[model samples]
Target: MLHVRAVCPAEHTAEVVELLREHPGAAHLVLHRGAAVSPEGDLVEADVAREAADEIVDGLCGLGLDRTGGITLEALDTAVSDAADAAEEAAPGEAADAVVWQELLGRTGEESRVNATFLGFLAIACLLAAVGVLTDSPVTVVGAMVVGPEFGPLAAIAVGLVLHRGDLVRRAGLALLVGFPVAMAVTLAGVLAGSAAGIFDPGTIDGNHDVDFVYQVGPASFVVALLAGAAGMLAMTSAKSAALVGVFISVTTVPAAGYVVVAAVAGRWDRAGFSLLQLVVNLAGIVLAAAIVLIVRWRRQRSAPLLRPLSRG
Candidate 1:
């Protein structure tokens, strides 16, 4: 369930109430008339079932409430009300299956921005992976993957493509286009420094170990990337984020990019080429899988509002 807080203009308060009254999924509805000071208006609140949130938000937007005032949704850690249980039961679909598009777009918009923090995390993750590649340490590579922030924008790109939002697609593209190259450059410098200090042995990397997986662009890589992408999409949409760490470790994106850097710095052109191939394959698989997941999740539901019509006296 989601707790929705809305500030509706005076003119739209009645419409807002009528709309909520029509939705069985809206429970514990509260209205405070003329209570808001900033952009002064009425304050309306409700606990809405996840299955019905998309429709309720759509109705509110259709009434122009978003422009006039604003609405915000917060997930409940626990809702112990009988009313909440009843609302969920009355909603047409299972809560777990629902996809709140507005919420997702809003989330991806914030994450897709190309900023210093985003780049910093990417650079650090890549540098860590460079160390992992040169030393042939699977543990270090997994750590880099966990620290990498690339998946957020990657998921944003998929969301943009699914929703046909050009701006989001461009934003996500910019982040990726700039971030990966910058991370690779930093990793290259790090590898050079490590080599000069005798911390990284190129011979270790040249041999077969867990690090070899970072450059092996085979059928297994593609299959794992697809599975990771779908799992990532599910983690992003659901309330629980524990699945995200598993998603992170399951893909070879950061490690592959890191291998490209280390191999290029070591003047191993063949290894660099294969590492780049691995990077491309993983990214392509992830994006395609995420886009497919979003399409199927959003397009499946077709039904009337979960709220039954009010009786005509």
Candidate 2:
């Protein structure tokens, strides 16, 4: 279930109440008239089932509430009310299967930000993977994968393409187009510095059979990425953080980037080239697979609001 808080103008409060009253999934509606200070409007709140969130959010936005006021959604971590249970039952689909497009777009928009924190996470992930690659440590490589934030932007790109939003697509693209190269550069610098300090032997990366899969691009790499992509999008839409970590660990994207760093430092262009190819293939596969998953989900839900979030005009 989701807790929806919408600030409605006094004139729209009655209409909003009527809309909520008529909707089966909108349970326990509360209207505090003339209570909003920031927006100076009536505060309307409700407990809405996940399956019905799209419709309710769209209805609220269609009434021009988003422009004049605002609406916010928060997950009900634990809902003990019988009303919530009945609301979920009355909704059209299962809560787990529902795709709240507005919430998803909002989430992806944040993930697409190419900010300092985003770059720092990516760079640290690459550096960790460099250690794993050079030391031939599978455990370290998996740890690196879990630390990588690359999936966030990849999922954002998929969401953008699915929604046909140019702004989101561009933002997410910029994150990837710049994030990977910057992370690789940072990882390389770290590796060179480590070599100078006798802390790492970059030349050992060539014969490290344990982590060789990072540079080896075969059918399995693409297949795993495709599967991970689908899972990642599913996790993103459902906001399942645990499943998302699994998706991250299933991909070779970060490990490939780390491999590229170490291999290049060793002057093994052949290994570096393959690792780069691996990186490209993994990234492309995830984007392609995730886009397909989202597109299919959108198409299958014929009742879902199409571009309702984009109906600002």
Candidate 3:
């Protein structure tokens, strides 16, 4: 379930209250008229089923409340009300299968932002992957994959494309476009520093190591990326985010970028090119698969009659 708190304009307060009161998936409605000073409106709160979150939020957005007012949703760990249980039971779809478009937009919006934290995580993850490749350590490589924060923007780009939100697409694109180069540059610096310190030789990247999969670009790579992308979108939309770890480890996006840097630094143009291609291939596969799945799911949700919540006149 979700707890919704909204500040609505004076003229829209009654309508908002009626919307919640009539919605089968909403209960425990509270309206505090003229309670807000900053926004200068009424404060309305309600408990709503997770399955109906997408619909409820969409309606609010359609009413222009998101722009003229404010709407926030918080997950309820435990709602010990019979009304809450009834709301969930009355909603059409299962909560586990709900898409919650607003949730996706909000989450990916933040994740896709190009910030120091995002770049730092990517750089550190790629550097770890560089070390993993140099040592031919599969465990280290997997750890790097898990540490990489690139998946958020990737999923954001997919959702943006599916929803035709140019802002989201641009933000996600900026994050990826800038993030990779930044991470690679950091990896290059790390490589140079380690070399100057005599920590490891650049030639460690030359031979056929156990981590060949990082630069081996093949059909299997694309297949795995495709599957991972679908699973990733499924997890995001349905809120089964525990599956994200598997999605991270299954794709080689970060490792390939790290290998590209190590190969280039070692004067191995052939290997560098292969690794670059691998990175592109995996990225393309994941985004393409995720976009396709999101489109289909959105269409299904749009076509379902249950998406229309019962609102009072």
Residue 69 accuracy (lDDT) in model 2: 82
Best by TM-score: 2
Q: Tens digits of per-residue lDDT for model 1 on 80-194? A: 9999999999988788778877788888888888999999999999998988887778999999999999888889999988877778889988999999999998888888887
- In candidate 3, stretches whose alpha carbon ends up further than 4 angstroms from where it belongs are 304-313
Model 1 clash tally, residue pairs: 1
**Tens-digit per-residue lDDT, 1-313, candidate 2:** 9999999888899888888878999898999989998888999999999989989988988888987888899998988999889998999988888888889888888888899999999999999999999899999999999999988888888888878887888988999989999999999889999999999999887578999889889999899999999999988877676798889889899899998878888998998899989998899899999999998889877665565554222
Give the C-alpha lDDT of model 3: 0.89
Candidate 3 local lDDT, 1-313, one digit each (tens) = 9999988899998888888899999999998989999889999999999998878887776677887888899988899999999999999979988888777878888899999999999999999999998888889999999999999999989988877777888989999999999999999999989989999688977664799889899999999999999999999988888999999999999999999998988899999999999999999999999999998888878753322221211
Clashes of 2: 0
Among all candidates shown, the one with the greatest lDDT:
3
| TM-scores of the candidates in the order shown | 0.93, 0.96, 0.95
Candidate 2: where are CA atoms >4 Å away? Answer: 310-313
Candidate 1 ranges beyond 4 A from true positions: 302-313
**lDDT (C-alpha, whole model) for all candidates:** 0.86, 0.88, 0.89
* Error at 262, model 2, angstroms: 0.9
Q: Give the TM-score of candidate 2.
A: 0.96
TM-score, candidate number 3: 0.95
Top-down TM-score ranking: 2, 3, 1
